[model samples]
Target: MRFVRESGLYPDVPVPEVYAWNTTFENPARAPYVLMEFIKGKAFNLVVRDDDPGLLSGLCAVPESQQVALVKAMARLKASLSKPVPFTEIGSLVVDSSGTFSVGPLMAIYGVSLGSPYKSIEDFWRASHEQRLLEKIPNFCARTEESFQPSERFTPHDLMDRYQKLSALIPYFKIPEPYTPLVLHHPDLALRNIFFDEESLLSDDPKVACVIDWSGAQILPLMLASCIRIFRGHRYTGIVVIK
Candidate 1:
C-alpha cells in the first residue's frame, strides 16, 4: 500500500487502485490480501505459441531473437533480487495452474533442488572420493538424508570414509560439486507463463507488466537458469531480448 501508492507508479491513480488493503470493509469484514493494478493483455503463452516458435516446442525452432529476449527477461528476473526467496516462494515450487505436473512435486518432500544430481540424492552416497567439494557437500547431503527415506546421510567425514571404502571397488565414481550454490536458476521459466506485446518481438509487454505466478522461480546462478531453458516447452523461448 505504502510503496505502490506512495511510489510514483502511475499518474494520479494507478490502473486498479489498492483500495482497503485487498478488499472492502463496506458492511461485512473481509480477508486481507495485497492489491495491484490489472492491465489487459494476452497471456504470453498464447502470443508466444502463435508468434514464432516457443521453447515449449522442442526441435520445432524459435527465432534466436525471441530466445534472446526470453533469456534477457530471465536474466532481469533472476538479477532483480539479491536475497533468495524461500523455496516455496519461488514460482517453480508452486502447483502448476495449467494442470501440468511439476518436477518440484516429486522433490518437494526431500527439500532438495531437482537439479541436485540423482546420485547425490541417492541412499548412502560415498563421501570423499565421490564428492568434488569434499567437506562442504557432506553436511548438505546429510541434511537431506536425515528424513529422506531410502537415503543414507553422510557428513563430510562420513563421506570421506565412504569414498575411501568405495575406491577399492568402483571405477571413476565422483559426485560433482553442488549445483545449488553454483548457479542462479529460474527452474520454472515455461512458455505458458510468458506474455508478449505487438510492438515487442516476443514480449508484447517489454516493461514486465506483471510477472504472475512466481512459484517456480529460483535464484541459483545464470548457468542454471540458462540450462533450464533446455527443458522449456515449445511456446517458451526463455526470456526474449527485444532491446
Candidate 2:
C-alpha cells in the first residue's frame, strides 16, 4: 500500500487517502491485508437512473485523450514494480507483472471461489482447498462454456484442452501485465469502487475518480476485455487501447 501510494505515476494526482494501513502482523496464522480509508463511492450497479441514468453517458463523454492518460498511469504502475514477485507473498504491491491475475483473490473475497489457485496464473486451482472446480482444462472449458451462449468461435472443451490458443489472447485485450509478466489492472476499478467529493467532483471532467476494489486484477486479456465491456462506459476514460 505504501509503495504504490508513494511511488505511483499519480503520486500527485490527488487520489483517495490511503493513510491507514496495517501490513505487519506478529502472528503468521492471520491472513495479511492492508486497510486504507474506505473510499466513499457509488457502484455502477442497480442500473443508471434518469438523473445520472447509466454509466454509458459518462462512458461516451470521455475523450480519446483521457483514455491514453489512464493507460499511461497503469503502465507507470506496472513499470514501478520489481520483477519475479513470488506467488505466495503477493500483497497489493504487485511486484510480479505476470502473476497479476484476478480470479483467486476475487473469488475468495466475494464468496464465489472460482476454481482454485493452480500453477498457471490464468488457471486457478484450489488455493488451499481439496475440492476444485476442474480436475483438468477440458473440464474447466466445459464448465465455462455453460455460462455463455453456445458459439462456434470456441467451445468450453477447447478452452480447457488448448493452452497456446488462450495464451495468445493477451495482446488482443491490451491488458497490462504486472505482478507476473501479464498485465497491471485495477481489478476492482468500477464505478462502485470509486470515491469522490460529490457529483460536482466531476465538473472539470467527470470520470472514475479513484479506482478501488483490487480483487480481479492481473493480465488475463479475455477477462480484461470482458470487464471493459461490462464496466467501462461513456464516463470511463482511462482504458488503454492495444493499437
Candidate 3:
C-alpha cells in the first residue's frame, strides 16, 4: 500500500490506511487482521444492475456510458499497478524489523508452506509444478482408510503420469521478454472489491474511490498479473480490450 501510494501512479484510487495489523495468530485477535480506515462508498457490483429490479444485480443492466467509465477507472488502476518496483526476488512484500520493506519468502498459498524467495521466474514455476506433482497429487490420490471410490474418470496412476510429463516441460516453457519483470497484483480486482461514490455513475467520469481487500496480493510476472478474470465471460458492446 505504501509503495503504490508513493509511486503516485493512480492518485485517485485510495488504498485503505492501515492503522494497525497482526500477520500472525499470536495476537489476541487469534487470526491475521488489519485495522484499516473504514471507507464509505457503494460497491461497484451493486451500483450496476439490470432493469428487472430483482434480487440479483450486475453489469448486465448498466448503461454503455457507465460501463465505459467504470472500465476506464479499472484500467487506470491496473495500469498504475503494473509499474515495476525494485524487487530482485520473487515473493510477498514484507516489512523488516528496522521498518524497511523487501520481498520475503512467498506466502503458503503460492509456495510450499512459506517457500523461500525465488531468484528467477523459471525457478518459481518449476518448484510450483514439482509441488503439485510430488505433494498435492499424492495427497489427492491417497486412499482413505474408510471404503472409498475414485470419482475421477482417470485413475490415480494416470493422473500421476500426466503430471510427470507436464513437469518435464516446465524447463522448456520460456517467458516472454516484456513479461519478465515482476509487479504487484491484487489477487482479486472484481467489481465487488471496488468502491465508489453513487454519484459517479451519473456522470461521464466514473472514479473509483477505494480499492479494498489487499489480502494475498502478490509480486507476479507481468503476463500473469495483467489478467482480470471478471471480464473474461463478459459480453457487451464496445468492450475495451486491455493490453
Candidate 4:
C-alpha cells in the first residue's frame, strides 16, 4: 500500500500506516509480522443482515443503492491502481536496498519456492502449467494415494495430461498488444477485505476507507488484471474477462 499511497490517486481512501515490520523468522515475533495502523471502519459485509435472503433474487443483502455505491468505489480504486503502476515483467513487487521498487521472483504457492521473474506473459503462463504438471500433480498424487479410493483419486499421469492440454491452449488465450502491459492485481478483493464507514451506507456514495490483505498481489497483464470478479453466495466466481 506504500505504492498506492504514493500514487496520490485515492485521497479519501487510506491504507494502514506501518509502524514496524520484520520479514524474517529471526525476529522476536517468531514469525514475520507487521505492526500497522488500526483503522476504525466496518467491513463491507457488516452493512448487511446475515439472515437476509435477498441474494436469492440475484442481489446480496446490501441494498441495490448501496451495492451500486460499493461497486463505484471499488471500481475507482481498481482503475486508479491500474494506471499509475506498470511493470515490464510479471512478478511480485519488491523494494531493494535503495528503496526502489521492482518486480521480483514470484511465489507460486504460499512462497513455497520463488520462481524466476517472467519477462513475458507467455513465460509466466508456461512456467505455471509446467510447475503444476511436473511438481504439484506428483506431490498431490503421492499425498492422497493412501487415503482416497482409486476411482476418486487422480493419477499423476491423468492430472499431468489434463494440465498439458490446458497448457497447449495458451496461445489461443493470448491478449493483443493494447492490453498486455503488466499491472498490479489483488489476488483477493472480497468484501471482507474492503472497509468503509458504517454511516456511509446511508449515503448514495459510500467511500471505501481501506482495502487489506494484499498478501499475494502480483503484476499481471492488463487483460488478466482488468477482469471482473463476481461474488456468489460465499465464494468468488473467478475473474471474467472480455477481449
Winner by lDDT: 3
Query: To one decimal, what is the Cα RMSD in angstroms of model 2 from the true structure?
Result: 10.1
lDDT of 2 by residue, 42-66 (tens): 4334325466654434433444554
Each model's backbone clash number: 43, 36, 1, 0
Instruction: Point to the candidate with the largest TM-score.
Output: 3
- Give each model a TM-score: 0.36, 0.37, 0.78, 0.74
List the candidates ranked by TM-score, beginning with the highest: 3, 4, 2, 1
Off by over 4 Å in 4: 7-13, 47-59, 84-86, 108-114, 136-169, 227-231, 234-243
Clashes of 4: 0
| Candidate 3 accuracy as TM-score | 0.78
Query: What residue runs in model 2 are displaced by over 4 Å at the alpha carbon?
Result: 12-14, 19-35, 38-183, 197-204, 207-209, 215-243
Candidate 2, which ten residues in sequence have the lowest lDDT sum? 124-133
Against the reference, the lDDT scores of all candidates come to 0.40, 0.41, 0.71, 0.68
Candidate 1 C-alpha lDDT tens digits along 12-39: 2222444434223543445535555565
lDDT tens string, model 4, 1-243? 666566564465478876676688998889998888888887765554547643332236556665566666667767755754656777887776666778888854366544758887778778877876666654675565566666775666678688878988987877898888777777676666788777784466776678887665677777777754436653333332211
Q: What's model 4's overall lDDT?
A: 0.68
Off by over 4 Å in 3: 7-12, 28-31, 48-56, 108-114, 139-153, 231-238, 241-243
Off by over 4 Å in 1: 1-37, 48-62, 82-187, 203-207, 216-227, 230-243
Candidate 4 backbone collisions, by pair: none
Candidate 3, pairs of clashing residues: 50-61
* Candidate 3 lDDT: 0.71
Cα deviation in Å at residue 23, candidate 4? 2.5
